[model samples]
Structures are given as C-alpha cells and as structure tokens.
Target: MLTLKYFFEPNVTINYPFEKGPLSPRFRGEHALRRYPTGEERCIACKLCEAICPAQAITIEAEEREDGSRRTTRYDIDMTKCIYCGFCQEACPVDAIVEGPNFEFSTETHEELLYDKEKLLENGDRWESEIAENLRSESLYR
Candidate 1:
C-alpha cells in the first residue's frame, strides 16, 4: 500500500546532466583565484590560505615585484589532497581565493588535478558572475 502511494506520487529524481539543483549560498565547490574589477589579481601573496589549509593542499610562493608590490609567483592547489573544508577561503583576507559553485571538475589524470595559478585565474574569469552572486547571497545571511 505504502509502496504504491510513493510510486504514484510525483517523480522527484533529478536529471543531473540536463538540470542542476539549487545550491545553497554557502556551498563551496571548485577553487578559483579572483581578480579585481580593475583586472588586477586580488591575491597579495599573504599566504594566509596556505597556513589555514588543514589538508595542506594549497601552496603559494611570494615575491616582491620591481614596483615594490607583493605578488604570488607560484600558486598551486592539489585538488586530490583537498578536503574542501573551506578554510582557505575563510583565511583569505582579500577574497582572492574562493571556492566557487562548480563541482564538475573531473579530470582524466591525477597530474591534471594539480591546479596552477593560470588555471585558477581562468576559472575565476569563467565563473566570476556566479561566484559574486554566491558571495552576495552568503553575506545576506551574515
């Protein structure tokens, strides 16, 4: 009787490929490096994210540029090692490093999962709108 009632009810299964379910405001997904509206990279090379990552997935190397501004020369994240604890995002004071709403980053090889600065910047550019919206939504509840 109960089985028949549930079977006759409306279908609730998600067609994951064709349609995506609504993500929460605090949903942390793929990691990305954000840039300012002026097109400059937001990371000041503070290395705070690196320090906070419990999984030790994040690594950053900083250097002082000729113009006397601090910048990161090497920024890498090992996605395989990451626990997605969102600590790195919270540790970033400049909001340079953020976990955006993109969890479909499956790779064919393990080496491909080691994200470099350029790749992260590309992800930032690609998902800036969604990332910003997610951040805005997150702030509303705070």
Candidate 2:
C-alpha cells in the first residue's frame, strides 16, 4: 500500500528542535533598531517608520537631545498588530529600523509582544551582523 512505502524509507520530516530548517535571504522576522559604528543611534526621529506603518503598529515620540540632536523619546512597536509587510524598514532612510532574521521570539503574554525602544535596541545589538549582511545582500539587486 502507499502508506506502507514510507515504512521502509527514512524520515523526511526534520526534528525541529534538534535540526533547523533553511530560511530565505529576505525573510522578515523580528524588528530591530540599529546604530552607527560611532555608537550613535541611526534613528533621527524622522517618524517615517511610524507614518508608513500600514497596520499602525508603530508609535514614536521625538525630542531634541542636549547636544541639539534630534532623537526619539519613545519608540514602540506592537508586534501583535504588525503585518510584517516590511514597510517600516523600507521607510527608514538611515536603515535604522530593520526586521532581523530572528523568528524565535515568542512570548507567553500579549503584553510581552509589545516591544519598547529598549527591547528593539537590544534586538538590534544582538543581531547587528546578521541584519547588516541581509541588507547588504538584498541591496545588490537594486
């Protein structure tokens, strides 16, 4: 029978926790806020990301810093509301906001899905290299 044919063959399904699957170069997963090499945050509080979010998941508040630099006082992204359309990343002129290759971010509560500025920044720091590489590879065609 057709069902019995598989009994003699090896398992096609991968053990998820033990074996990882492949991902595409343009996979959009977790959101992150990047910084410049000089230790300055790349986001200039332009609010472009907030404006372009179709789902209205992004919220930003800006203020002038002591050194006369414009910066965001509050930047929050509601992950639950995000449609993962990559609009926020495209709207960012400075490449400050990016969706990193991190799909493992799962929380028990809905409140934890609401990412604050600090959480985004931390994600940025943690996945900077991967984010940069993904961006670089993606920019080659354009």
TM-score of every model versus the real structure: 0.93, 0.89
Tens-digit per-residue lDDT, 9-123, candidate 2? 9988999978988877789999999999987899999999999999999999999989998999899999999999999998899999999999998899999999999999999
lDDT of all predictions: 0.94, 0.93
RMSD of each: 1.4, 2.0
* Per-residue alpha-carbon lDDT of candidate 1 for residues 9-116, written as tens digits (9 for 90 to 100): 987988988988998868999999999999999999999999999999998999999999999999999999999999998888888999999989998999999999
For model 1, where is the 10-residue window of minimal lDDT?
Answer: 133-142
lDDT of 1: 0.94
**Best TM-score goes to which candidate?**
1
Taking all chains together, the TM-score of candidate 1 against the true structure is: 0.93
Q: Which stretches of candidate 1 lie over 4 Å from their true place?
A: none
lDDT of 2 at 139: 96
Model 2 worst lDDT window (10 residues): 133-142
The residue ranges of model 2 lying beyond 4 angstroms of the native Cα positions read 1-11, 66-68
